[model samples]
Target chain A: MSKYLLNKFLYTVDRDPELVERYREDPRGTVAWWEAERANQLLNCHTGEASTWLAFDDPEREALVAHDYVKLFELGAHPFLTLTLFIAAFERDHAEPLGFQKEYALRLQHFSLPYPDIAT
Target chain B: MAELAAVIASTHHPFYYRASTARGEDRPPFADEWVRKITAFRETLTRANPDVLVMVGSDHFHQLWLDNMPQFLIGKAPVYDANWYNEEREFGLPRMVLKGQEDLSGYLLREGLDAGFDLAFSNELRIDHSITCPIITLRPEADLPIVPVYTNIFAPPLPQPKRFVQLGRTIRELIESWPSDQRVAVIGTGHLSLELGGPRQFGPHGPDPEFDQRAVEWIANGDLEGCLSEVTLDSLHAPGNATHGFMDFMLMMGVAGEGAKADYVDTLDLFHTMEAYFTWYPSGGPGLSEERACEPRSEGKGESA
Candidate 1:
C-alpha cells in the first residue's frame, strides 16, 4: 500500500500549492497533517520495514522528496502520472488524439469523475 | 596534459536488466545480441585503460528533486557511494564505494560556472541508473575513478542541446589544461528513442526503432550538424517525453569534437537504443582541429583502432 499512499500523497501535493508550501516549511508536520487526514491509509501502507513515508529534517531533505514528486507527477517521469501532465502543464500533443490527453480523458471516464475540460 | 582517450555513448535504460535476464517469452531477438555487443564494447574500454572515466549523464529525479533542482551538477567525492534509490533497486547494483576524482570535479565546477553554466557541486550526490546501468555493463570492474557531470533532462527546462554541446567543449578544455598526465575517457550514458512511463511508451507505440536507426547512423557517420538540426527539442520530446537521453549524445559529440572517428556502432532494434564508440587521437585523423573542436563539437568521432 506504499504505492497507494505514495500515489495519494503525490496526487494531493500535485494539486495543492498550500500543502506544498506547508511541506516546504515543515516536512515532518506536513506528514503529520497528512497522517491526521489519512492515518488509516498510511498505516495500511506501512509494513514492518523502513518507512517510505516522507521524513526529512532539513530543507535539503524536503527538496529531495519534492524533486521526486516533481519528476514523477509534475514532470511526466512516471506513466500514469504522465497523463496528469495534460491538465497540469497544458502541453498539447503534436498529432491527433493526443496520447496523454486521450488516456487522461478515459481515466476520468473510468473513475466517473467530471472531465476537466483541459485546454491543451 | 590529460589526454582524451575515448568518448563512448550507450543506452542506460533500467529495463536493460529485464532484457538481460529474460528466460523464455520476454527475450527479444536483440537481447542476446545486445549483451554480446556491449561485452565487446567493454573489451574495447578495457584496452583503452583510461585512468579516469568522466561520465556525462542526466538525473532521474532520484537524486535531485524539484524544490532545489540544479540545471547542472558535478560530483566532488573521492569515492562515490552507489546507493540505489527507488526504481534502481531492480538493478541490484552493489552499495559499494567507487573511486571519484575530486580534482576534475572542482575544475569542472569552477570553469563550468565561469562559462555561464549554473553548476551545482555535491560531494554526496547519489547516481541513478542512467549512469550505473552503463557502468555495470561496460565498466563492470567499477575500479576506475570517475567524475560525473549531470544535467536535468528528466524534467522541463532541460538544458538546451547547444548548451550541452558547450558543456562538452568545456570538459574538453579542462581535460586539455590539466597538468596531470591522466589518460581520460568520457562515457556519455543514455541514447536514442525511448518512451517510458507514458501510455504510448509500450504496445504499438512503445519505441520508435525507425527514429533510433536513423539517429544512430547519423552519429556513427559523424554527422554532428545533421544530428543537431534534426534531433530538435521537440523531436526528442516526442513519443512520451522519452528521448531526452539524446542530450547525452549531443554532449558526447561536443566532447569528442569533429575530428574523432566512430570506431564501433550498434543499434538495438528492440529497445530503440543505439550505442557508439568514438576515439580522438593526439595525432591527425578526421576529427576537428583543436580550435574547431572547441566550437560546439559532437561526441561521436575519434581515432579508429
Candidate 2:
C-alpha cells in the first residue's frame, strides 16, 4: 500500500494540463505509462538520481486505471488529491456548479467517521 | 517597537474571487451579501492602517509537498508571486505579486527559533489561494508588503492544535518586540467544520454547523482554554475531515490573546461552508474613532460572545 506513490501520481498529474487531459481521456494508458516511466523519478531531483524502490502495488494500479476514486479512498489515497484531479478531469461534464462534487460525495456516502488513514 | 495594529482571522474561500466578481446572470444569488460582509470586514483592517501584514495560511500541496514538508515555515524573500496555475484553473483567481518585508521575516525566524520553534524559511515561494484570497477581499489594492507564514494543517504528522496557538502567541510577541515603527497586522485564514473530498462535502451547509457555531464562539471570545480543553488532534475529526484548518483560527486566537473579545465580528452562512471574519484592535487602533470603536459588532448570522 504505497499511499505516497498513489499521492505522487495524483499530485503530479493534477498539476500538468497535458497529464490531466491525458489521464481523463485514457486512464489505463496513462496509469501504465506513469508507472513504467515516471514512478521512480524523484520530483525535486534529476532523473539519474531517481529512487528505484517506488512503485504502486496491484490494487493501487487497478484503482487508478479504473478511475475508481472510491477504491482510491478505500486504499488510503489522499482524498484532496483524488478529488482535485477528478474534478479537473470531470467537472466540465456536469452542467451545474458543484454538480460533480455533490455526486462525488453521494458516491462515497458509505464512508463514515475515521475514514481511511491517509498518513504516508 | 512596532505597534501590533490589528489581529484579523477569516475563512479563505477561493471561490470568493469569482463569485464576488461575476457579472449579471453569471453571479450567484449569494454574491451580493458576501460582498457586503466582506466590504465591512475589509474596513476593520483599513481602519488600522497597517504598513506590513504578517499573513498566516497553510499550503495546500501547491509548493509544499509531503515528501519533505515543513511543519511551520516563513517566507523570507523580497518579493512573493501569488496564486498558481491550479488555483487559477479551479478558482478563477488572478495572478498577483506582493512585496515582502524580509526584515520582519528575518526577525521572526531569528527570534522565533530562540523562542523554541524550529521554523523553516523559504526564499522564493509562490503563495496559493490561502494567502491571496484575503488580499483580494481585504486589501484588494495588494499594496502592503507582507510576510507569509505557512502552517502544516493539510498534511498528517501535523503539529498539535495547541502548537498553532503557541506559534500565534509567539508571532504576536515577536512582532511587538521588533525595533521598528511600522504598524503590523497579523492576518490568518482557516476553515470551520469543513469537509472536502468526503461523504459530507459540498452539502447545503458546512459538514457540521453545530461545531461551526461552537468554534466561532471559542474564537470570537478568545476562549483558548475552552477551545484547547475540547479540541484535540484526534477529536477534530468528528467535526469534519478538513476541520484541521480550524487550527489556523486557533492560532489567530492566540495572537489576539486570552480573554480578548474581538471588537469586530461577522459571519456569512454560505453554501458548502460558513464564512467567519474577526478583528481585534490591541491598542484601540489608529484610525478607529471613539464612536466607531464603541459600535456594536455586526451579527451577520452568528453572535460573538
Candidate 3:
C-alpha cells in the first residue's frame, strides 16, 4: 500500500530466538544496523497480521519469503533487491550471514531456462 | 493461448544510479521518483492475477561468475520476496512474497529440448537483481509466483542471440503444456541501450536516444534476434551492458511467443550506457483477461529466418 524506493524494503536479522538474543548481546557486530532509522520504522510498521520478509531461492532454485529472516536483515540495515536466485551479501553467503537464517529460505516452483556456461 | 506478459533482463554496469554508475565511484544511494514509478507498475502487474512468471535475465555474482555460477537455473518456491540493494550496507533489503512456484521443472525440460537449449537445471539457487528487478517491477510485494531462467550475460561463453530466442519458445511450450489453467507473465529484464559505467565513459548521463530508440524498436518488433544477428558482441557492448546480455531478451521473446504490445511506458534517460522501457505482450487485446488458455504459440522453427 505504501511506496518503497524500488522494491518492498524491509530489514532483518537472525530469526532463531537464541541467535537474536546473541545479536542483542554483541554490540559491535551489529551496532550500525541497530541504529539505522528505517530498521526502527519497519519494526513499528509490522502489526503481526501482515509483514514481508526477505525473498530468496533455495539451494535448488526454490523461492522463499521467510519474513522472520527478513526481519533479521531489516534489523541489521541490509536491504537488497534480487530475483529468482537466493539473495547474498557482499560480506557473507545467504546461509551463514545473519546468524544462519536457513529456515527462511523459500523454494518456489519454476522451470529453468537454458542459455550457457551458467554453472550453479 | 500462452502469451508473453513482460520481459525482464539483467545487466552489469550500473546505469540507473549515477552515484553508483562508475566503478568504485560510490555516491550516496538513491530511491528517487523514478524508483517510485517502477514500484507502482509492480502493483499493476499483481492486480492482473497471473500464474507463473517466466524470468529471463543475467547473473552477476548471485548465480555464476568466473569463480562460481550456473549457466542455466530455475526457481521453485511457494513464496519469496524481491529485494532492493542498500549500497550503504552492501546487503539486501528483504521484501516478502505471498505465494508462488508450481513445480514446472518437467515442462521446462520438455520445451527446452524441443527449443534446442542446453539447460543447467537446479533446485537450489539465489537469484540476483538481473532476475529480480523485473519481477519486482511487475509484482513489487512479491505476491506473485514465478518460474525463473538464468542467462549468462555476465560471464563468458554466453548463448548467442538466436539461441536465446529458442529458449523463449520453450517457455511457451512449458506454459501451454501445463494444465492448471493459470494465467502467466513473462518478464525480460535488461536495458534498451546501456553503456555501462556510463557516467565514466560518456559522462554522467544516459545513452544517446538514437541508439536506445533503435534497440527499443527491435524489442517491440520482436526482432531482437535479428538485431543481435546484425551486430557482433563487441559492438553490442559499446552501447553498454544492456547489449552485453541482450541476446537473452531474444530467448524471452521466444517464450512470450511473438508480439510485443505497442505500449512502452516511461522511456527515461536514466543514465549513460543505460535506458529503461516497460512494455508487454498483450495476452489477448484490450478487455481480455491475462490468462493464456489457448494453444502454445506456433514455433518460429528457428530463432530467426
Candidate 4:
C-alpha cells in the first residue's frame, strides 16, 4: 500500500549496515524508530506480518533480517532491490566507474528526482 | 491468435548513466553518442506500438536461484508489484504495478508445456534490470502490458542452444494459436560479451569484439543455424561471464523465426561491456516462408529444392 515507505525502509537498510545491526539489537526499538520516522509505514509489504517482526526476539530478528544483509536481500537468487547490484558494481574494477549507478541516475532524471547522495 | 509485430534484441547493460565518461573531442567519456542511440531506439519502439511486449531476459540470481531455478519461467500475474525486484529506487521505474497478460500467460503455460517446454509459472514473480532497464529506457506508454520470461542463462547448466531455439519456436507457435488480435512484440535483453567482476575486471574482460561482430553478422543475415550452432557456451563465456547475454539473443532469433532480417544493428563499446542493439523483421509476414526456405526444402522427402 505505502510503497514509498517500503522503498525507504529497504533503501535505508540496504544503504547502511549499521542500521541493520541496530535493527537486530533492538527489533522493537528499531522498528519503532522506522515507524516514528514513517520508514516502515508499509512494513507489512516488506515483511509478511509486521507484528511477527515486532514480537521477534533480538536473535530471532537478527536471524530473520540481519544475518546476511547482502545475501538476504534476495528471495532466492534475484535481489529484492536493484541497489544491491548497484552496490556490488563497485566490487569490480573497470576503467569506468559506477556503470550501473550512472545509468540508474539517468533513469531517475526521467522522474524529475535528484540523483542519490549515497556514496558507493 | 496474436500477430507478432516486431522483435528486438539489446545489450541490457546499465550504460544509461555513464555519459560523462565519453572520451575524445566528445569529452572524456562518450556520453552524447549513447544518449542519441538510446533516444532513437526508444522512439523506434514507440513508433512500433505493440499492444503487448513479451520480455525475454536472463535472471540476475534475484528471483530464480541455482537451488531451484528452472530453465525457463513465465510470470502469470495480471498485475505485479515490481518493487519487490528493484533495489535502485532512483531509476524512476514505476515499481508499484506492472501490467501483465493473465490469459495470454495461461495459454503460454499450457501450450508451452504441450510444445515440450516445462515452463515454470509464478504469480508472485519479481524481475530485475534485465526487464526493467529496457522498459524504462524505452518509455512505453503506461497501457502496454508485458509478459516476463525468465531464462537461466547466467548460471551453469544453461539450456543447450537447440533447446533455447526450441523454446522460442514454441512461443511463436503459442502466440500464433492465440485468437487475440493483440499486436505482440518480443524484446530480448542481454549483451554479447560482458564479464562482471571476473578476471578481466581491471581491463577488457567479458565482452569480445570478435564475438560481437560475428554475432551481428549471423543475426543480420538471419542465419539461424549459424547463430544456434556457431555460438556455444564456451564462445559466449570466453570473453567473460557477461556473454551469457547471447542466450536472450538466441530466444529472440527463435521467435523472430529463421527468416527474420536485421533491420538495424548498433554496438556500444562501453567499459567492461560490448553492448549491441538489434531490431529485426520477418522478411515478409512472420517469416514463415523464410523459415521454409531454410529447411532442406525437402528434408523429409529426400531432395533439395
Provide the lowest-lDDT 10-residue window in model 3 chain B. B295-304
Please give the TM-score that candidate 1 achieves against the real structure: 0.68
lDDT of 4 by residue, B1-305 (tens): 57777788887754363343445764534577677677766754665667898888876655564336688999999875553323443332445457898888888999888877888989877777788767755753446788999888765567787777778878887887888999787888876765443333324333466776777666655678888767776666575555666777888878877856665566666665665666654423444344434422111212221
Q: What share of the true interface contacts does each candidate keep?
A: 0.10, 0.82, 0.00, 0.00
Least accurate 10 contiguous residues by lDDT in model 2 chain B: B296-305
Query: What are the clash counts of all predictions, listed in order?
Result: 21, 0, 89, 27
lDDT of 4 by residue, A1-120 (tens): 222233344445544556645755665677557655543233325544243122323333342344332222222222233345334323243345555444433333332111121111
lDDT of 2 by residue, A81-119 (tens): 999999999999999989999999999999997899988
**Candidate 1 CAPRI assessment class:** incorrect
Q: Which CAPRI quality tier does the interface of model 4 achieve?
A: incorrect
lDDT of 1 by residue, A1-120 (tens): 133344445445544546645655665677667755642343324544334454323332342244333333322234333333223333233344245444543333322111111111
Q: What value does DockQ give for candidate 1?
A: 0.10
Give the whole-model CA lDDT for all candidates, comma-separated: 0.60, 0.92, 0.45, 0.60
Which portions of model 1 miss their true places by more than 4 Å? A1-120, B18-30, B204-206, B271-305
Output the better candidate (2/4) by TM-score.
2
Model 2 global lDDT (CA atoms, 0 to 1): 0.92
Tens digits of per-residue lDDT, candidate 1, B221-280, equal 556777778776666755334677777787877787753456555544443234444333
Candidate 2 segments whose C-alpha is farther than 4 A from its true place? B287-289, B292-305
